[model samples]
Target: MENNRAALILAADNSPLQVGPGPDQSSPAADEVVIKVAAVAINPSEWKMKEFSYIPLKYPHVLGSDVAGTVVKVGEEVKRFKAGDRVIGHCLGLVYGGAKHGGFQNFTTLREAVTAPIPDAASFQDAVVLPLGISTAAAGLFDDLKLQLPSANVNDDKPRDEAVLVWGAASSMGSIAVQLAVAAGYSVITTASAKNQDYARALTGGKHIAAFDYQSPSVVGDIVDHIRSAKGVKLVGAYDCVGFESSTRACAEVLHELNGGGVLPSVLVPPEASSLPAGIKAHIVNAAAPGMVAGSPGAAVWREYVPRALANGSLRMRPEPEIVGTGLDRIEEALNLHKAGVSAKKLVVLL
Candidate 1:
């Protein structure tokens, strides 16, 4: 049914996803563009929401975020896209609340602010990885951490005397954070497992000031000493992409020792308040918030920066895509695999 005009629907909390009728062909809002979704990328939130009903959601809803495909139609107020345009968008079914905006369906509506045209070099499968990963990264880097925004022109960068710490840089969201920070001309300090250390560094084109092995017991000391004694570059803040207690604690402690205190934006939940180091704090970031509002940092990145960066090859679809299967039924298998855990790659389902 995903091949036709059908949806992968969730009937109730903790229920299995069922292939069913797609959303009705309704008139899109002035800023919305409907797409024939060619590919959808899986995120941890999708599986978690279904298994635990973690987020407030209506039953019989569709859940997904990352989408890449051809624009089938656009509303009157949408000037950037026309039918047949190849594009990628962050679907907010989870946020806007319903099946219509969900990416798991064959066709879905996405806001123009969060949608960007894809270049010929970026395939549907490849570009699908960008929407949520890059959105979350932009949200954390710009809105949450209040760092300088990224420029579409990489050469326009004036290197800053600061570095950002991105824990778990090989994950979907963290990888983009590393690249976006470098794109904004800030040197990055990243940590990943040995298998992903090189991957994380390459995301920033080796612009990283230092990279660390998360498995090493000396990692905290290593990060501290490197940031402290470096000839230049101060630590502005840290981003905990892993969201585990250990990752958040490590980042909080590093910020406490180096910067006296700092804000940390996490992918999921932050550490308990009682466990945080003095003067250090962490907050969870929401990628959908920026897209919902016009002229936001997230909107600008999605509108101007994404298309340009993707066209010029400054942004590579990283952690890479691990194609799990094709079609609606295979989505469940993909979800299971994503739940099992992946490293240095994203799970994608082709429709």
Candidate 2:
């Protein structure tokens, strides 16, 4: 029997999204595969875009970024993946030059470039949580900042001791950034709420991580003091997972304190810092804009780095997501929870 189920759709105004069953599944394109989505992860962009309408949202647009599912069908030209392959990928959502549909449905279609086989060890819930954040973190730390990976030869005498601070370490992207940074041989100092401190340390392989409550007024000073006290804190860099004004400003202050004589990389737009300390640079992480397919750089990164990392175990699945509801009917509640703020955990809806 044909699968007919409701999908969460965004109206033209980008207002509250609605869940409704609209159409039957469409055949895959030559380079596409049809996936029976098992889980979908929410991202801040889903709500942020509502205000800007930056991406063209055709009426009834689907808004979701991360997905893990089984491939039920594939088009003639789809080679890297086949039917029955379990996979996870960034949905790219319909608004941002993405596929015709997104992951927030019982089924969605994706091109070969953005899809990758999920690890045998990962569950659908955990697998879905990694792609979007891990991909961005990899792109930011490795590609944008041009940081080198550690060599196998221990005596190679490379500067593997330099530290990189990950602001907002408990966030999904922040959490992944810690792991990727540690794997690359940089000591990681991250900030998270007091409750998530211990969990943050385990995720990053237990390095020089420190958790600070963003709610505390002294958070900025705490980060700066931590970096300054570290031995040989030269050539420092940072990744700001939270892009709010305060988070960016706090990171900026710490970077200024470090004064490592190089640019500090940020995943979000950096705050304007006049009178910045000497030898500090700030670059916004446009992870999706590089090596993009048909002028989409984000897609290119997803295609290139995501697969190898998964295959090599350089990236691992996050905590298993709590799957809330199945199909489109559950979207409104999910969005409401996202708007209200997640409690240091990811909320996913199965489709």
Q: Largest TM-score belongs to which candidate?
A: 1
Quick one: best lDDT, which candidate?
1
Runs off by more than 4 Å, candidate 2: 1-10, 21-31, 75-77, 94-99, 149-159, 208-218, 260-267, 272-284, 290-314
TM-score to true structure, per model:
0.96, 0.82
Residue-wise C-alpha lDDT for candidate 2, range 101-141, written one tens digit per residue:
56677777766666778767767877888767865786677
Q: Would you list the clashing residue pairs of candidate 1?
A: none
RMSD of 2: 4.0
Question: Per-residue error at 319 for model 1, in Å?
Answer: 1.7
In order, the Cα lDDT scores of the candidates are: 0.84, 0.67
Model 2, residue 267: displacement in angstroms?
4.1
Q: Give the TM-score of candidate 1.
A: 0.96
Query: What TM-score, to 2 decimals, does candidate 2 have?
Result: 0.82
Q: Over the full model, what C-alpha lDDT does candidate 1 score relative to the true structure? A: 0.84
- Cα-based lDDT at residue 64, candidate 1: 88
